[model samples]
Target: MDNKNRYSISDQSIRFLNKYLNSFSPTGYEREGQKIWKDYISSYVEKIVTDLYGTVVGVINPNNSPYKLIIEAHADEISWYVNYITEDGLIYVSRNGGSDHQIAPSKKVVIHTKKGLVNGVFGWPAIHTRKSLEEKKPNLDNIFIDIGAFDKKEVEEMGVHVGCFITYPDEFFIMNHNYFVCRSLDNKIGGFIIAEVAKMIIEHGIDLQFGLYVVNSVQEEVGLRGAKMISHAIKPHIAIVTDVTHDTSTPMIDKKIQGDIKCGLGPVIGYAPSIHKKIREFIIDTSKNKKISFQRLVSSRYTGTDTDAFAYSNKGVLSSLISIPLKYMHTTVEMVHKKDVEKIIQLIFETLKGINYSKEKFFID
Candidate 1:
């Protein structure tokens, strides 16, 4: 371990990361995950507050300075909700937030209910039963979950009902010692990374003149709802958003179409209409000054993340994106490289460190 062990990610933080990522923070139902986030970041910040929709904010320097800055990431993961129950207890679902039905076959899932969780599996037709050419593709209409119940009555007895959320049972994992593989890493990893930033700031004893709002937003997958409400409330002058981008180097992904980015290469900085050019340039400058390698990409109409929410809120808060290159996004086995994770943390930390309100004009040219 280095001399700055506490500043580095500790074993305890890793434990928290696993638990947080494993928890059910499905869209519109993020209270459990918000509790986890608030508890973990409580000691690191001066104050903590949650909005009506369960968006948690850890405030480091609560004040009214024009330099108010927000480091943000969404907390919700894509999920499904029970839409119907068959006579034989098979459950049909509707996407809660961009939940991919294409990957549903044979995957284990857990149905959340008022009573508790009921285990289930997404069942598909056996290969023998499926005709080679006439086999039906997996789609929202045909995908369903079986909970080992004989009838709908038995399923009801087990406490599952319509509107109850369902999530994958897949847990957090590290592959090849550097790749983080897990469900919901799309934005939950963003929450983890921002929390680590707060922890490091406390450990390093760095004080900021402006308020640092560390926001873990909810319902971003459902169209940035969580960030929308909270960003309007915080009205931060500068917002730095972190979320995942596709690892186009992976098989089946066309680099020309998705942009040439890869995990273990570096964090991807997004240029978009929502991204303020001056603030974006500031991040690029920070990456260069700190010698942190970074990749670049462009988003046309929207960044498809929380950056759009904050950028256009409250007279347009300066916003930019720092994305972790992720493979298999919106799936059970989302993967990100530990090296890029480290660089993203370093880059954001350095940017925050160098953002001196007294000397910095983030957007004003």
Candidate 2:
């Protein structure tokens, strides 16, 4: 069997993708999701190392190589924190990590509590009762969730309280045949792609020149906290961070502001000051050489992804960002093209196979 024919995404991987995306992994709380990711990639890696705050790294060719490369993605999803429980047992929430209040109304939610998952729904006033001219939009102050509790006492009895993280219960599904739709595909798709890259390396029997660290970072929805801490711990020589970028072709999004990107157009490569110019060019070259389709996106001072964290780490790591085109980011219906997902996985896989360099030589040019 030919190498390319034998090595492609399998049914097992699709099953794992569905399972991983459906699991709750809110910012600052990603242990369970990380466990699922770690277990899936364990067979493909030489050894696995986890940090104090639950950043998981699957180290390949771990011979204490001075030159290390990292392929990373965040595991956490945007969520809401139970900020205030009203006397009527209504829960007002605060942003856990860019949670969209406008879309919260009528969506199903799961509040993570010590007692396990408690179901709830963001309740809104009936249109018949609201005066159109005086209607208020859903904001942090107005959006509330009802857990069918009549009063605060009932809510408390159900183990609901302030500071509990709430996530959407939306499961992964295929849309219009080629798009992956779910609530947190903003970055969980990234974790899945990195794992697929690892699987490719193992099945193809590719020998790596550097220690490859596949990192599933936590707390990215809040900030680049996980990537920041893990960068210091790994101190990699080169890093490729994958995340989601806006698909401005969708309705209501201005292409002039968000950049003109579309789903299924291939992986999007970010250009920013934080991205190392030398390594960025190397990745572009690799993509061209491999005949992979990719789009370019120019960013402001910071790329606003984990790339910034790794790029500005100790002594600076050569980092780049590869984003998948996503529609309706931060909403329950976040979507990404399946082909774009495959492109990113292929790009990273081919780049790793071609990166035969030392840290000293990388900085020379």
Candidate 3:
């Protein structure tokens, strides 16, 4: 495809990403997100299935191959849940996943209550009321959400119940020429990439030697729970875990510590023990041969992604991580490059075509 066509595809994917990010589908509350993903991906793939935990699994080659190839992207995003309602109508909430408390205060949010969606803003004590020492980072527990209700009874009447999901009400926007910012790009972007790959595979009719399973998992931010379950069930010979990594463009980040991955470069091919060396080599070689821009990220220990879960699942699976370099991870305004997103989709499609499942050794020696 030409550059213009490739950019068009990326732009379409960005639209999908925005819609998914804007929806309220945090952690345990993933039904809405799943419905959206299902509706978009159902007609493109050969078959689709939803697991017990609401993980959406799309199968392109289900019957022929002996080995299964599982690609995972979690559907859940970081969010909060209502914990208490004060007599004055203020709602106290507890975080559901890995959320930066510092960014929560003063941000607009949507509470997915029993009756309907109620808009609110995270509120905290003013700086003027705090002592000099207390002006430092305050605890998240002290934060509350104000929805303009009169009292606790009024708030309850508005259908704000305990355990209702609360998420950042941020919309996706293009920052510069190539960079974009939004909430929940961490794995929503990953899910969008997987779906885009599936669409390409279907349109091109690429012959595959192994069965491919594109799984949109749930609750990865908490502890990779969805990956653990799906990997165990699929028991694939090989797996690819897709997620986001730090861009480190802002101040206070050490370049040497996080390697040289950046937002506009391309997707970062992960190098870790859990990642099969042969698969990593195949991906790198394919990117080079295809003349696609790519970057390398080294992880000395376990990568904090679904790869960690898939590595040890069942008897043990050979798993690798393909990360999109993202700035401001786990925040309301996460940023990613549009080129990097397209590169990741191409890399994944090309890597799958290069797999040699009949080999005896797992890693290339």
Candidate 4:
């Protein structure tokens, strides 16, 4: 079963990836991004289910089945929330997720306001004026956004107020025609891959013994809130989750601390406590049989992605994780190899085609 042609990344898909990654889908404010994902997959699935908190599920086989399978990725990205408006119109923000404070200063951002997009820049002190030995570095406490407003009233007039969400304005771009560099790839790329898997499943006319739920979850950066909710809602018998793992091959990254993972090598298969041994082996077998390239990952206590959310749900769902090796995770310039992304989609697509949920041989005693 050669799936290279069917699951290969196309130019049209790259265009979609650019638009989707450039769109602001900050945590807790994911409706717009979910709409983009749901629209892209609507033609490929029979039914779409959106949770109250904006987790979107596209069901290929909606009818009742003996087993349910969920291939999920989170839609939300780390961002900031407007916590306070200084009298001088400077905006103080709090973490909406795990926003990197070190990268916040001097970066461009957009405040999602009721009026429209309000542009702002994170202000920092000049290096020349700072005493290097005693200078205070950028942190949540001191970092502030300058919107060029005179006072708090002026900021309010611009539709920027407390509780407004902010995200970087970094657009998606490809480097050397291979690496995808952008903000929020931490898991948006996950959503993109799973959606592509569903697309391939429909295009290739593959049949599965169990219902396949293509889930794009929300709020994963903030403790997997969305995955936790949807895992309960779906109650899937088996979950194959995809998220980004660090590519430790880059400069300044210690392989001993981050593990030996690299982009363009292959998809990553997780060895975590939450990962069901049988399910893990099943995916590895499928990858090997299909001649798909994949790397290995070992998680100490938890996989730290949506994998943990679903693995612990429904009194322990059988779960495995497949990750794309990502570089500079959680920053504006997060990157992954195009080959790795395509391989992940292929791996997930092939795994779904070959999985036998009804066969006890694939399940542990």
Candidate 5:
């Protein structure tokens, strides 16, 4: 596809991502986002179901393929919850997921309360007040959110209550021709990819021999909890976990320490023991045949994404990991290449087409 065609996909992905990312569905509170995903993907899939934990599963099976395949993505993002509302109305928050406190200071955030949405900024100690601790990075426990309310009564009147979810208020922005930045690309990109693949399967009228389940999991950022439940329920024969990996273009990271996966280099295929050797080879072969560029990533142990859950779910599944190279992971300004997104989707679609039920293999314990 040319740049124009690529942008079309990027534009659609960005539109869907922005709509879902701006929704107030942090880890344990993903009901709103789940509803949106169900509504959006219902038209394209054969059957859509929600697990007990609110994980959304979309199936597209044309020829009743014997093999069950899962493309897993997490819908949750890192966020904070109001733990205490002080007498002065400043809200102290507890981190909900794997949040990096270094990026919390002086950042804009949204407080999702029972009544309404409240805008706030994470405040850092003033320079004069921090003279003794100038070189120290403040911990998350010391951070507070200022919503411009003067007293506890005002905050209460504004519907700011304990347990309200708070997230960074960063809007999506296009950086270069194919690069874009957003707040929750950590896994929203994965959701977009699976949804688009479902749409393409329907549009092209391609029938797969195996059943394909596209899952938008919840609480992955917290502990990969959602995947564990859904994977057990589905008991897939093969699993592909899509998430963002580090893009080491910024300062402080050594290029050699991390593999040379860049934003526009296509998707990163993870090489870990948990990943099935045959499945990984098939993916690479498909990408090569389709002329899609991809990078090989080596993971020493367990990948800290949904792959960890799928690899060990219900006596284990043949699992592999594909990552979109993302710059500044876990921060408000996460960036990814639009071309890489398209390539990743294409790689996935092609891999689905290449699945054969008769060639199943097992790993020895």
Candidate 6:
């Protein structure tokens, strides 16, 4: 079979993706999820290195090539931090990484505590009890967690206190066998794609002339903290960053403001200040040659993903962004198309196969 035919998503991969996506990996607390990811990719890579902040790197063809290349994704997910526990045992929260306040009401949550997982629910008054015109919406101050505690002292006694990390209790599932839905797809899917690409290259016995860094970064929900630090340390010659973009085809999103990205179309290639022209063209060419479908996006200033972090780091490495179009990003029901995921994996794998120093070099002449 040819390389294209040989690369296929197996049942084991789907199982891994489900497990990894279901795992909680809130910002600054990504160690557990990172361990799961590292374990999955361990047998497929030659060596692995971890940073002080827990950004995991699986190295391919390590120490054999001077040129370094990176295919990266952030592992952290948007979550909430317990800001204050009221005297009546209601828990007010703050954003951990752009956690959407509007979606909090009536949702189930897991508050990570010293004891273990504490179940809670975001409480809201029934619409019938409130004046429709005067009804307040779910916001930072209004949304609170009810864990069945009667008082603040009981809440603390139950191991729930300020600074505890909170995440939606939503698990991964397929919709109509086409859409992958769950919280945190903004980036756990990115990590999954890179891992799949690495698996394909290794299982097929494909040799690379340059080093490949499969990076699962942390603190992206807070900022591009992990990517910033790791890019400087690795000093890679080229970087390909992947993350989720909004599927504007969904309701309430204006296509004029957000462009016309959709779930089932394909992966989206971004044009941004951080994107290197030659690298961008090469990726587009690879997509065309391999017959992989893709969409286009333009970012005026920044891509707002780790692409900026890696692109501007280490005296400016050549970098570009490829995004998986997702619906309801940052919400518990975030969804993506299965075909886009597979195509992205193929695009990255094929692009890497075509990168030869003698044939194509990064030059600005």
| Model 3 misplaced regions, further than 4 Å | 1-12, 131-133, 358-365
Winner on lDDT (5 vs 6): 6
lDDT of 5 by residue, 319-356 (tens): 99999999988888889998898888888988887776
What does the lDDT come to for candidate 3?
0.83
Q: Positional deviation of 178 in candidate 3, in angstroms? A: 1.5
Go through the candidates in order and give the C-alpha RMSD of each one to the true structure: 1.9, 1.8, 2.4, 1.5, 2.8, 1.3
lDDT accuracy of residue 254 in candidate 1: 76
Provide TM-scores for the models.
0.96, 0.96, 0.93, 0.96, 0.92, 0.98
Instruction: Decide which is better by TM-score, 2 or 5.
Output: 2
lDDT of each: 0.89, 0.90, 0.83, 0.90, 0.83, 0.91
- Tell me, by TM-score, which candidate is best: 6
Minimal lDDT window, size 10, model 4: 356-365
Task: Count clashing residue pairs in model 6.
Answer: 0
Note the clash tally of each candidate.
0, 0, 0, 0, 2, 0
Flag regions of model 5 displaced more than 4 Å: 1-14, 133-136, 359-365
Per-residue lDDT over 274-365 for candidate 3, one digit per residue giving the tens place of the 0 to 100 score: 88787778788888977878888898888888998988888878888899999888898898888898888888887776676666345333
- Collision pairs in model 3: none
Candidate 2 residue runs with Cα over 4 Å from true position: 1-7, 358-360
For model 6, the superposed segments whose C-alpha errors exceed 4 Å read 1-6, 363-365
* C-alpha lDDT of residue 63 in model 1: 63
Query: How does model 4 fare in lDDT?
Result: 0.90
